[model samples]
Target: MSAGLLILFYLGLSLGPLILAWAQELDPRTPWDELATGLGFLALAIILVEFLLLGRFRLVTGRVGSDVVMRSHQLLARAALVLAVLHPFFYISPRTPAPAWDVTRQSVVDQSWHALWPGIVAWLLLGGLVAMALAKEVSGLRYQHWRLLHGLGAAVIAGFGVLHALRAGRYSADPALAAVWLALLALALGALAYVYLIAPLLRLRRPWRVREVRHEADRTWVLTLTPDFRGRLPYRAGQFAWLNVGKPVVSLDENPFSIASAPSAGPEIEFLIKEQGDSTCRTGQIAPGTRAWLEAPHGHLIIDKHPDAAGIALVAGGVGLAPLMGILRELHATGDQRPTALIYGNRHAGQIAYGPELERLAREHGTELVHVLSEPPPGWTGETGLITPDLLRRHFGPPDRHGWLYVLCGPPPMLTMVEDTLIDMGIPAHRILSEQFVYD
Candidate 1:
């Protein structure tokens, strides 16, 4: 589907609950009371939608890049947390027994312990959940442990929030609204089940095996995987997959890595992995032929999406060159004669991966390869500084180059600098594609 259609679908899912509640035509309460209920309804809806925005759904992330989808998930979670936190405080009505005339609790909040307990539990847990998420990096939690906690916590919050809505909410007592809540809750839970259970079960049928693990650069390894089954791993050049080596299909030990091998280069997928966390730092120890599992082909960095572009400009930093290498190799293999340029920046020459192939691309395929080093070697002849605005302007300043498709993968700071410079140089935002290596 198109971007516009995806946006329309999202807006519809988010606003549909509010519209249904308004259609109930119940007696109106004070503005504050209505505002409180409105915020609760909206927050619940947003929380439910957060499941799909976890960047695992291809239907959602395929059109917009996973980086954009994951970023949206983070922002929307915070937004829902704020709305949920303030929802109870907005009620002006007293928490007391409803008068005979207000049988539906239209003018009073439900004070019964049964109705309020779920809401109280959900409310407090929501705060803690958001807090833990915001502090994930500094919380000293392992990535897999944090992921499991995050998923289970979200599921509990959704369950309790729905229960509270059904029992304590005045509008939620309506059958249509109650059905909406149930459906939303089911979907939220279903998303969890799909990610944790169903997807892994399917992956069991088409497992991969570790074919090789060769050290590519300083503290980096080129890990190759070949399918244990029949066909090749179908993926775009610039996409990535969650790889689990020597682990069960349902294990959370997997980490995402960009595909460094070209799709045209056959089924054996390759990943240039840099030593980072516990799982990645031990890539060298993973024996060949170890059973591996891959959640294949996720990302929108592929060049095929922008065939109208006059040229391709790939900007990569350090090991972020993995995906760009795939794109370059595919272009070269397919004999795509689009004018291509690569601006690769690293701390030193030793940090560059696939250096010989990159040089070959420049010599044989007419790719304008510019190597920028922050700490160059003693006898380096290339640029020796950060990839700055001046560097971009020197290479892509011409009027015709503005139409080129610029794909960037790098650390956050370099991405920000290059993206800002590109926009300042009159490159349209739609023409520039980028994915940050680190989401956290």
Candidate 2:
């Protein structure tokens, strides 16, 4: 789907509730009461739609990159929290049941303790959920444990929010509005079920086995995996997968890593992983033949979609080179004649992965390879310091700006700086694809 269409679809879903409620044409309440109702409807809709954003649905993430999807999920969650918190405060109406003289209840908001409890619970839990997400990095919770808690907490909040709307909302008495609320709730919970349960059940039939784990660069390892079955994963170059090495099929222990091996390179897959803390501490030490499961082929960093581009510029930082390697390999395997350049950045020479293979690509495929090191050793001939605008200007000048696709992967700071530089060079935003390391 196109970006415009995807955005319109989202706005339609999130705002549809308020539009429908306004169509009810009941007696208008005080401005503050109506404002409260409208905000509540928007909050509920936004919260419900968040499920699809993180649901790993290709239709959503395919057009928008996974990083975009994740960032949207985080930003929208905060907005929903703000709207939800302020939902009740704007009501100027009395707290009373619908009186016989006022069937529309325009003068009173739902005041029954039983009906109000759900909203109270949801309001408090929503605050906690957002706080947990904001503090995810410093929470001292394992990624998997944090993921489980996040998922369960979101599900509970959605249920309570929908219940409160149905039982207490003035416009919700309209069957149309109530049905939309229930349907949205079903989709929200159903998405959660599919991610945690249905997807795992399906994965059970297609397991993978760890083939090898070889040290690649400083503190980085190249882990190879081959499917235990006959079929290979249908994935595009520059995409990633969730790896669950030595973990259960339904386990949340899986971590996402960009696929380092091209789909053209047989059935085996490889991941260039940096040894971070926690589960990744065992990354370089995993024994071969370990049982593994992969929830794969996510991310929209693929280059094939831009066949019309004049050239390709791949920018990488450290292990971020993994996905770009997949793209370059696929191009080489397919004998793509388009001119391509790779600007790989790292802190030091030892941090660079796939040095020999990249050189081979430069020799055989005519790929322009440039390495940038922050802490270069003596007599270094390549660019020194971080990837600078001057460096990008020399490479992606206006002369080659016929929408040459620039794909980037790295730490958030590097991606941001490089992306801003690219746009400053008059490269249309659509021409760039990026996926950053999501610390959450």
Candidate 3:
């Protein structure tokens, strides 16, 4: 689906509950009480929608990049937390039993133990959930453990929140509003189940095996995976997949990596991984023929989406060259005639991946390759220092280059700086595509 349609669908789902409550047309409460109820309803709806934004659904993350989806999830969670926390304080209604005439409980807040206990529990748990997520690094929890905790905690909060709404909410007494809350709760929990259970079950049927693990640039390894089945995995050049090597289908040890090899490279998929984490650091040690699994084809960095562009500009920093390498290789393999250029930056010469192949592209495919190093070795003739605006102007400042599609994958600071520089140079924002290597 188009990005605009996806956003409209999201808005419809999030606002459906609030709109239903408003349509109930019950006796109106004071302004503060109405404000409290509105905030509470909105917060619960947003929290339910958070399940689909967890970066697991290909439909959601495929159009928008995974980094964008994940960043939205984090930001929206914080917003929901703020709304939920302030939901009760705005109430000016008395905390006492409802009067006989106040059938909709417009004169008093529901203070009975049965109605209030669930709210109290959910409120406290929601605070702790957001706190733990924000402080995950300092909490000293492993990524896998933290993921499990996060999923369970969210499930509990959803359960309690729904219960509180059905029991204590002024508008929730309407049968239609109660049904809407139940449906939303079911969908939220169903999304969780699909991610943790159903998806893994399907993955178990299409297992892969490690074909090779060869060392490349500094602290980097190029690992290849071959499917146990006959057919090859289909994917775009600049896309990525979740790699679960030497782990079970259900394990959370999988890490997302760009597919370094092109689709034309055959059944065996390749990944250029750096030794950064516990799973990645053991890349070289993984035995050939070890069992592996893949969650294929995620991300929106492919070239087919921008076919009308006159040219392509690829910018890479450190290990960020993986996906771009896939794009370059695909172009070369498919004999794509579009003009192409690469601006690769590294701290030292030893850090550049596929150096000889890149030179081959420069010679055979007419790709313009510019190497930028922060710390150049002796006799180095290339540009020095970071990828500055001056260097960008030297290559891409031409009026013709402004129409070319600019694709970037790099460190967060470098991506931000280069993106800003591109925009400042009058390149339209729609022509620039970038994905950051780090989401946290």
Candidate 4:
């Protein structure tokens, strides 16, 4: 979907309940009471919508990119938490039985044990859930354990929140708003089931086996996988896949890695994984024939979608060169004649991956290859210092270079600087595509 449409869809889903509640034309309460109900409606809707954001649905992330979707998931979750936290406090209505004349029960807020218990439990769980997520990196918990806890916690909170709304909320008593809550709750649960249960079961049919594992650069290993099935995976050049190496179908051990080889490179796939994390640190120990499960291609840092561009500029740092390599390889295999440039930055000479292959591309593919090193070797001949705007100006400063497509994949700080520099240089925002690995 286009970005505007995706945002419109999200607003509709998040605000639809509130709009429906207002349309009920029920008896009016105090301004504070109505505001409290509005907050509750929005909070629950956003909470339920969180399920779809992290569900890895292609229809949602295909256009906006996984990074955008995941970031949205994190931000919206915090917004919902804030609204939920203040929802009850804003209610100034008296905590008493509804008078005989107040048929709509708008005169007082419900305070019965059954009505309050579910909301209290859900509210507390929501706080814990967000806290655990924010502390995931430092918690020392396995990625799989964190995922399970987060999914189950969200499901429980959604269930209880809906129950509380039905029992305690005056506007929520309307059958229209009640049905909306139930549907959202059902969808939230369904999303969890699809991610944890259905997707894994379906992946069993497309198994893969590790074909080769070899050292490439400093602390980086190149892994090659071959399908045990009939055909190759249909993926765009720069997309990523979730690989569950030596794990069960229902396992949460899967991790996303960008494809380092092009689809045109045949059935075998390659990934340049840097030893930095739990599974990645043990890359060298993985056997050549280990069983693996492959998920569908996920990412939007692709050049094929921008066929109108006059040139392709690939900017990468460290192991972030994985996806950019796939795009370059694809261009070479298809004999694309569009002008291409690669500005790769690393700490030193030893950190540059695929040295011979990149030089070969420069020689044969006529790619304008430039390497930036923060700490150069004794006989360094390439550019020295980080990839600054001054360095970028040397290559992309010309008016003719304004129409080139710039693809970036790197750490957050480097990406931010490069993107800003490119935009400032008059390259349109839509032409710059990027993806970073930052799940937490």
Give the count of colliding residue pairs in each prediction: 0, 0, 0, 0
RMSD of each: 1.0, 1.5, 1.0, 1.1
Clashes of 2: 0
Candidate 2 lowest-lDDT run of ten: 394-403
Clashes of 4: 0
Candidate with more favorable, higher TM-score: 1 or 2: 1
Q: What clash pairs does model 1 have?
A: none
- Residues 1-440 of candidate 3 have per-residue lDDT tens digits of 98899899889888888899889888789999999999999889999999989888888998888999999889988999999999999999899898898887989998889988888898999899999998988998988889899999999999999999999988898889899899989999999999878888898878999999999999999999999987878899999998899877888788899999999978889999999877789999999999999988888898888989999999999899999999999989998999999999999999999999999999999999999999999999998999998899989998999889999999999999999999999999888889887668
Q: Quote the positional error of residue 270 for candidate 3 in Å.
A: 0.5
Taking all chains together, the TM-score of candidate 4 against the true structure is: 0.98
| TM-score of each predicted structure versus truth | 0.98, 0.97, 0.98, 0.98
Candidate 1 local lDDT, 1-440, one digit each (tens): 88789989988888888999899888899999999999998898999889988888888889998888888888998999999999989998998899898877887988789998888898888889889988998999998999999999999999999999999889888898899889989988999899888999899889898899998999999999899999988899999998889988888788889999999999899999999989999999999999999997899898998999999999999999999999999999999999999999999888889999899999999999999999999999999899999999999999989889999999989999999999999999999989887777
Against the unseen true structure, what C-alpha lDDT does each candidate score? 0.91, 0.90, 0.91, 0.92
lDDT of 2 by residue, 271-371 (tens): 99998978877898899999999997898998888889888889998889999999999988988898899999999999999999999999988899999
Candidate 2 lDDT score relative to the true structure? 0.90
Off by over 4 Å in 2: 401-403
Greater-TM-score candidate between 2 and 3: 3
At residue 41, give the lDDT of candidate 3: 92
Q: Model 1, stretches more than 4 Å misplaced?
A: none
How far out, in Å, is residue 150 in model 1?
A: 0.6
Off by over 4 Å in 4: none
